[model samples]
Target: MSGLRQEIGQKAQAEGFSTPRFARLAHDLEQQARLRAFIAEGRHGDMAWMAETEERRGSPLSLWPEAKSAIVLAHSYGQEFDPLERLQDKQSGVIASYALNRDYHLLVKGKLKRLGQWLSHRAKTKVKVFLDTAPVMEKPLAQKAGLGWQGKHTNLVSRELGSWFFIGTIFTTAEIEPDAPEQDHCGSCRACLDICPTAAFPAPYQLDARRCISYLTIEHEGHIAPEFRVAMGNRIYGCDDCLAVCPWNKFAAAASDARLLARDALTSPPLSQLLELDDAAFRALFTASPVKRSGRNRFLRNVLIAAGNSGDTALVPKVTALLSDPSPLVRAMAVWALSRLTAKPEFAALRNDLMNSEADMDVRREWETA
Candidate 1:
């Protein structure tokens, strides 16, 4: 039993994953109850999938009945540079550090799948692997496996890896020893809470996804509400403010995985350049990246808000061009951006010129408000 755990850890580390930890399958519902409360309070916002898969997320066995043990691994995506530093360049759109290069889903999950295959063949037992794509409540399972503790921001924080690692798991019928769960280390630190541009945290450990810029920019499909636009600043993809400020990050090393390093273009993409990304260009820019999954219209909608916050009058013409964008999500945000970057009279003139011709009620509302 102990040999199997050692073997899996060695194999996972060889595959660019952290040394694996083990946890036994159980009928635990502690995390599930918290999930229920989060959904009941509508803290998940438009992430309806969390509610849709509520029962299935109860435990690993919910997804696989035959499982008796679990193997957990962490893959670090820590950056060499401070991601917050990029936020200072207001003229450029800041993408979350995680999405600055290759998508983790493909890289992390692919490595885990190979590890699972090896374990199944060696032990002659069935195995199933999972990452963020599954409803397995990975953070809780990771904590149970002694991988890390869920910190004040509701993200798992490892003493060795800080807050910059992705969790992966393999569930198998073979019984293995479960490691002692990691204990909470967050004391009086309020850096992650106070640094939020939109005040996403309602209480110490409670997050309101509605106010989260990451949710607003990535998951929320509709037009960004006016209040969060300015706070969003130049973040066009996702916000890393809370994650970057964690003091635990001092222990995190720069990612050794060459595949996960930040791409030159995505590090601090200029708002002017990003705004010019039409559908085809957008696809080309983010073909293998996670940003593509959010789709062009939604990404542009965020960029326009960043443009609004930029105060870079140089972007005014580019922002004006998006007024005629086919997507109302883009056009509405364009109206909002123009109001900020251009003079009031110029914005009023553009509205007077474009309002009557605008058909979408949402775009018309933007014009009426501008």
Candidate 2:
């Protein structure tokens, strides 16, 4: 079993994955209870899918009845520099490091499929692959597989790889030896908790996704809540403040995968230029990138919030032009941006002129409120 684990690890490294670990296909009773509790408390916010697929997500056994063992893989996407440093540049939009390149779903899934095939051939057994796209509760499974422990931020953090990595899973019917699960090493450290701009962590190891900027800019649709908008700063795509402050990251290596490298354009995009993106321009710029999943409307909505928080009057013109954007979500955020950049009297004048013709209830309300 030990020799088999070493062989699998070597194979994973040669195939471009960080390392592979194995976990038995048993019910994770504690994880199941925590997940059910999270749904009951509504901490998942608008991610109702967590509740919808609770049974399947609760255990690897339930997700795949034939699965006897789970192989977990990690791929490092560590940033060469601190991602949080961009917050000082209000004129720039801060995209999460992960989204700054090609989507990991494509890259990680490809690796997982290849590895699964190799393992199937070697062990002469059926195997299945999964990435973030599946409801597999990857974090807990990764911990169970001895890859890493879940840090206080509710993200997998490794002593060797830190928190900047993507997870991939391969479930096989072949009975494989399982590694001992990792224990929490966070101790008294609260770096991830204190670094959060939105105080999204209710307690260590628990997150309120509702207040999380990543959820707001990505999964969340429509107008962002007023309280979170300003705290969002210029983080237009996703937030990484918590991940950046983890002390364990000092030992991490730079991302080896060229496909996961941050594109220069997305590293710190100019808010002024981002605000100008129409649907077609947005699609072109973000094609194959994770940001495209937000769509032009939601993406622009996030950019407008950043513009409003930018405190740069120079962006007033660009934001004003979006007052009549086809997407009501964009127009509403544009009103908020204009309100921040324009004087009350001027903003009132613009709102009065725009309100009469606006039929969207949400946009009209933004005008009335602004």
**TM-score of each model, in listed order:** 0.98, 0.98
- Measured by TM-score, the strongest candidate is 1
In model 1, what is the error at residue 322, expressed in angstroms? 0.9
In the order shown, what is each candidate's alpha-carbon RMSD? 0.9, 1.1
| Candidate 1 lDDT by residue in tens digits, 84-153 | 9998999999989888899999999999899999999999999999988889888889888999888888
lDDT of 2 by residue, 212-307 (tens): 999999999768888898899999998989989999998788789988889888999999899999889999899899999999999999999999
User: Which portions of model 2 miss their true places by more than 4 Å?
Assistant: none
**Alpha-carbon runs more than 4 Å astray in model 1:** none
In model 2, the Cα lDDT at residue 348 comes to 84
Residue 138 CA error for candidate 1 (Å)? 0.4
